[model samples]
Target: MALDIEQVRHVANLARLALSDEEIAVYQEQLSEILEYASSLAELDTEAIPPTAQVIALPGVTRDD
Candidate 1:
């Protein structure tokens, strides 16, 4: 999905950013690319994956006086 200049401008307005024409163009491209990449991640199949609190495997810590 391509983002239009007006959408970018609206985002900038919401963000309170006073972007110049050049900056708006640059940000529009970057934001669009980032969104596209994030969208691609939605294709992952995680039906058999288990949810965990942490990525690194570690035992719980304990303290004794």
Candidate 2:
């Protein structure tokens, strides 16, 4: 699940980013770790479980401009 530097660079390029070598290297590791952690969620079994529910409701507040 490790993301390579090339892939990160490609994504940055698609977003029109101008990343330096240091930044690219940093993202390569950070993004890889994130993907690895997220992939662990695939092992969860939610078939018989109820969907996630909201614990609290927040009343909407709006300011009239």
lDDT of 1 by residue, 34-56 (tens): 98998889888988999998999
The weakest ten consecutive residues by lDDT in model 2 span 51-60
Q: Global lDDT for candidate 2?
A: 0.90
**Model 1 pairs in collision:** none
Top candidate, metric TM-score? 1
Q: Which stretches of candidate 2 lie over 4 Å from their true place?
A: 52-65
lDDT at 30, model 2: 93
Tens-place lDDT digits, model 2, residues 1-65? 98888999999999999999999999999999998888899878879986655667667678777
C-alpha TM-score for every candidate:
0.76, 0.72
How many clashes show up per model? 0, 0
